[model samples]
Target: MTPPAESCPALVLNADFRPLSYFPLSLWPWQEAVKAVFLDRVNIVAEYDRHVRSPSFEMALPSVISLKEFVPASRRPAFTRFNVFLRDKFTCQYCAVRFPTHELTFDHVIPRAHGGRTTWTNVVTACSACNLRKGSKNLRECGMELKKTTRQPTTIELQLNGRAFPPNFLHESWRDFLYWDSELDPW
Candidate 1:
């Protein structure tokens, strides 16, 4: 027999890595997501186009669902930014200036030649001019200072994976995590 479809829901986050909303992985454009809704306690508002019987003992029959629980502060979200440019918002990290995505380049705060690993904390997105001007040189040597402190990617970032921000992603609660914040969780 084929594996049965699942009704599991996914947790959503705000731009700041704050817990925002939840969605049944299946929910889409038709309706608004609700907060404080999760698991069997939450109701199933819709379903896929095909007909099927509700599975017994399932948590909820979610055509779509949003969870009620805010992610506990204790949970350290994973960072996802396979592309350095998206990780830095197509902006120069050192100068903190926005640029077109195409104009951005990868930068190593600590040059790999000098012991930098290819990790989020060590890298950033930089504009062409910024990258060229600081090429292969440490900030101190270039007499430049980074506008923001570089840190590991946040939970929201880990989910983004260099993909363009999803149009449908900015729902309730998620707004707090998606705007202005640079970090993200690996989905």
Candidate 2:
């Protein structure tokens, strides 16, 4: 069965040909991608086999698109739950175990009860068990050790970490743009 247009999202890249974001695997819905094409805001680097048509015209859904102008990245990554998880590589800093986003939680290295402020310097990704065990106590009190020191992550640091997690769905057309420099099999 043919998938719906909604399933056909286009991977969006900056003018430099790099993806706008890696962790989220920057993508735009088919409708927005088509609109961008019409507005000349982006160039279709690759396209899907499926096509959309109106009374006036028809065009293949864009599988990949690149911006006409470069978009600069922010110097500092946002201080959000997701970014915290990404900065820690989705691993519990205390136990050093990887978890799915749903299973992970962020914890204050220095518990708020001890005058810890909720900032990048004090927060770290943690598992539910560790968070519970360390609740309202400093790491020393809980006998827990951090896998790494907590600090604000640079945008580049987060971007590099984001590359470690590729989206589950990668269209064939996107592979070239995403992993062009990856080692290839001799055979």
Candidate 3:
């Protein structure tokens, strides 16, 4: 497994929240969380430049980045909670009930026995009762309904990285041609 998002580092996004790529913790000068928050995409408009006298090249800053739409600038994704718990908000995605953290389990929206993969789209948070009853059966068979639509990873991975980063920070080295695009913000 990879290192923790905080210590392991984070990825950047475009102003539209499209994922760019991962960056290491030491590569950036700003807070880890802050980098995760602002990095939306790579610098497409501007290219990196280096000086002949200097050994280091310029940092590749974000031309524009997509900020997370649901959470606020103040909050970040919580990776420690695990993806299933994160997707279900720690509540049963089916049944509309809440359970103790331990009592909650991951349920396959599409049963694994039916060829479902262990992807974020196929699994969700569920209470023990709901999961057991729904066990490896199709939803139509059990008359169960999904609370929220399920899909694959969006910013979940990047959000996961940002949880441990510092606040309001981006790498200073990348500022050469990079400028914040507020209009592109709000993904």
Q: What are the per-residue Cα lDDT tens digits for candidate 2 across 1-187?
A: 7678999999999999999999888999999999999999999999998899999998999999999999999998889999999999999998999999999998988788889899999999999999999999887888989988888999889988988888888888999878734788898
Cα deviation at 76, candidate 2, in Å, is 0.5
Spell out the clash pairs found in candidate 2.
Answer: none
Winner on lDDT (1 vs 3): 3
TM-score attained by model 2 = 0.95
Model 3: per-residue Cα lDDT over 91-117, one tens digit each = 798888877578888877788889987
Q: Is candidate 2 or candidate 3 better by lDDT?
A: 2
List candidate 1 segments past 4 Å from native. 1-64, 67-90, 156-187
lDDT of 3 at 55: 67
Candidate 1 vs 2: which has more lDDT? 2
Model 2: runs farther than 4 Å from truth?
Answer: 184-187
- lDDT scores in order: 0.51, 0.92, 0.52
- What TM-score goes with each of the models? 0.45, 0.95, 0.41
Please give the range of 10 consecutive residues that has the lowest summed lDDT in model 2.
Answer: 176-185
The candidate scoring highest on lDDT is 2
